[model samples]
Target chain A: MEIISFMIAPLAATLILGGILVYFGIHVIKREIVFIDIALAQIAALGGTLAIVLWPETINGGGHEEGHHLIEYLFSLLFTTLAAGLFSLLKSKKIRIPLEALIGISYAVATTAMVIILDKGAGSDVHIHDMLTGAILWVGWDKVLRLAGMVLIVALFHWVFRKNMMNLTDNYDNSSYKSKRKNWWDFLFYFTFGLVIVEAVQVGGILTVFAFLIIPASTTLLFFSTWRARILAGLLLTVILTIPALWVSWTWDLPASPVLILFLGIILIISGLVYQIKKKVT
Target chain B: MNTLLFLGPPIVISVLLSIILGYFGNHILSRGIIFIDIAVAQVAALGTMIGLLVGFGEESLGLEMTSYFFTIVVIGIFALTKFADQKVPQEAYIGIIYCLGLGLALLLAERISGGSNFISKTITGNILWTTWKDVWISLLLFSLIGAIHVFFQKRFQSISLNKSENSSINRTRLYDMLFYMTFGIVIVKAVPIGGIFLIFILLIAPAVSVTLFTNNWRKRLIGSWIIGSTGSVTGILLSYSLNISNGPAIVCLLGSLAVILTLWVILRKRTVSV
Candidate 1:
């Protein structure tokens, strides 16, 4: 009972954060701006790394995990948001960049800065370590709540932009919405998108975040057409897998992120095989 | 004078590698092997992690060091993709290889070196203390590979674009000769610096940027190489001045080039319309 209850909070967090990422992935796949999503996600990791090491530890000089959970979660989100906003500014003309390329460069810069940080007395630092790879098992109440909040915000924003989002994806829709108050809304989409991707990193590290954004949403694109179905498929699949993965992580003493990714892969293979079998049967 | 000598080999290597990667990558992008490059590089990255695991953060493991760590995958990729089974759509197979390989890599990394080390090291690695020889070797391979690509540009272009189903070169089918060689070299070249993450950028980003504006394949090819080289030089300079690591700086610098080019294209299209 206690174990199950322990699991519940993070599960809710996963639902919200995972949903935002799934939506973000779906939208970016449409926009052909995934490379930016990719870069920003890494930058957010960089931001998290900087957040941890830049602060002076109390006694251990680094191993302030359980005590500083609140600080860690809050700072990760804040920095990731900042990184997202900075790159999203590529849409501005005065800044000078094609938004896509700007993102690629930003990814490069962020990752590079991260490399610098890591090299300059960083690898030894647990704060730098934890930020890049999320310490999922140790996720406290604060982290869960944070993820849930982001997820809720994403859900609200997604509900508002449903029509515009659909319109933007389809060519016919894009033509009509071209005149229907675009530029700023586009920023909203991309900005909120950055938040989703970055925050997902906090919950799941870079590898898992990429897999989270990509596999389910992309796989759903295989069969489903409607926005609702796609979101449902992505969310449902994510929940289905996240549970086993996390459970398996605790059981086998494996890392949650990799286990989650493997679940995704296994799900993909099974899904593929199912398709194959159905094709044969039909 | 020493600085030029210091910089000479890596820069030349960079230009050469950029040229090769650009030309071949353009061809591959047209042929739709973009993700394959990424997949293979990631696979190699997984291989390197296996190396790290074997060494256990220690440099040597006597005879057991770095051997067969990637044996399963090296053989798998080599056999499946070495131009033998080119008839069917092997793109899916290649993608599968990448996913599976990375999965194994993560598991191994997690088991041996804790999950955090597994994730961070795989994606954002350190090149802060690279040796001069490392730079020179990168220069050598990048140049050789780049020259080969330039020499075969016309052939690559023919195979890439004029996909007339039954071309004389059997462009799609002729992977036996070229793709594997390029594949092997790409892994070899990409391994030293970017880890698993940056190889795709090295392969695709510049080439894709060039594709945005230029319809003419020649210009597209040339532009990709130029942007890539410029990115490399710029990254090196940034690293020098900012005291940043080389790999991320290069990635960042090239990213800037891509953004700049993309912006110009967007604005140009916008202006021309009015």
Candidate 2:
């Protein structure tokens, strides 16, 4: 009972984020840029690391101090949006390099640069690890409220731009070179997506951000034929699995973030296997 | 003068490694598996992490075996996993493997003492602290791999770059093994000494830069070597004068060069079209 009350804060935040991630996952799966979240998250983390380097007072392993969270948040926002801009610009037809290659390169560069910065600033690897898998157990009401507000803003934006959002992940090779407006839509999508990722990463850590973004949609795609059904399935799966994941963490006193990721991976694999079996049977 | 004397050997070693790696980088880009080096290197790190957990020091034979063991596992999986469905890009699988290796490494890192520092070191390797032994071992291993590439250069290129020409089944399979094995060897050695970032920069940046101007393998190889060597030498000199870490300094130099070359190619193509 004590554990449940303690976990209630993170659990609520997880459910809300999970609901939002279902929408993001639709775009991510259709686009087939599965690692974009990982890339964006790394870029965001680099921003936070830069903040740490610049203002040493904002450092903490479990969580950042409240008053200075804005400093890190602003940096994270700036870095990810810049990355998104570069990525969108790289979409020009004349640039023969594949977007996937650029994304992979961006991930490598952002991560290494973070390490280099952290190393010079007398930061420890634990900070990087924490950044990768955050201390979700330490989440307070204020952090959850902040995350909820970010999700609401993104959700409202997605609602307002439903048509563009629908086409955001359509077959890129066809529509990628069609119009400047289309490119603008892509940039806007990435920019807004980056904002959510920066918050999601801070709240849940990198692995959870990726899992929520990829696993839910990926698992649903295995069973559902349409985007609507897939999103519904993803939402259902998140609600179902996140509870057990939190419970497992509570019961074992293990870190909830990795445990949650482990559950997501297991559920994804199981869904994939079941889908394969169903395909074989039919 | 003393700085010159101290930095010369490592810089020269970096140049030689860069030339060979630049060659491999072109092949890797051609193969469309740009992230394989980092993937294989992470597996090696995972192996090294496990070795440490089990009480084997970094330099111990046990750790060496574990590192090689993990590298071979990844290389085997990557070489053999051929999907019948062509819809899924190979990059997806490479991304998956990389995430798995890194996630497991982070999880393991939590248990090891000073694991974060160790992991960071693995990524941005400390080249300034390298010994002559590190240089010689890299030279020997790279030479062996380079020999395989030189001898079977045509067969390897046909299997990797010109996939349609690889109709001879047995020969194709043989060279495929040779390619992955040699790649595995280079990454295993390069990661520990050059750090993952520097090695990745050396492997991809140079090769990718040359792709902007030419597709001819010979010209690309030579062009990449010149860029990589010059960048490394300059980076080393800067690191010495500025008292910064050699690995990041070199990575920044090479990374900037790659960006510049890519931009130049793009602009030149636009001008030609205009």
**Model 1 stretches with alpha carbons more than 4 Å out:** A32-36, A45-103, A116-121, A124-129, A172-179, B1-9, B28-38, B49-103, B113-155, B167-181, B194-201, B204-213, B268-272
lDDT per residue for candidate 2 within B1-274, as digits (tens), equals: 8877787668868887798889888888887677788778888888899889989976889999999988887787677654322333555555556656766777676698887777767766777777777778778877887887889888888766764772565556666877888888888887877888789888888877777678787998999999999988888888788777777778777776666666666667778999
Runs in model 2 with CA error above 4 Å? Answer: A22-26, A29-32, A45-68, A112-121, A175-177, A221-225, A275-282, B55-57, B85-87, B166-177, B267-274
How high a TM-score does candidate 2 get?
A: 0.88
Q: Please, what are the lDDT tens digits per residue for candidate 1 over residues A1-282?
A: 787887776676666656777777676655545455556666656656676666647325657676565565566567666655454444543322234444544665566666667666445445444544566666778767766777778779878867775665554223334535556566566667767666666666656666666667667766676778988999889888888778888888886766777888788767766655766798
Who wins the DockQ comparison?
2
Model 2 chain A scores worst on lDDT over the 10 consecutive residues at A171-180
Calculate DockQ per candidate and list them: 0.29, 0.33
Chain B, candidate 1: TM?
Answer: 0.70
TM-score of each: 0.75, 0.88
For the predicted complex of model 2, DockQ is 0.33
lDDT accuracy of residue B54 in candidate 2: 87
Q: Which pairs of residues clash in candidate 1, taking residues 3 or more apart in a chain or in different chains?
A: A98-B263, A101-B259, A102-B259, A105-B255
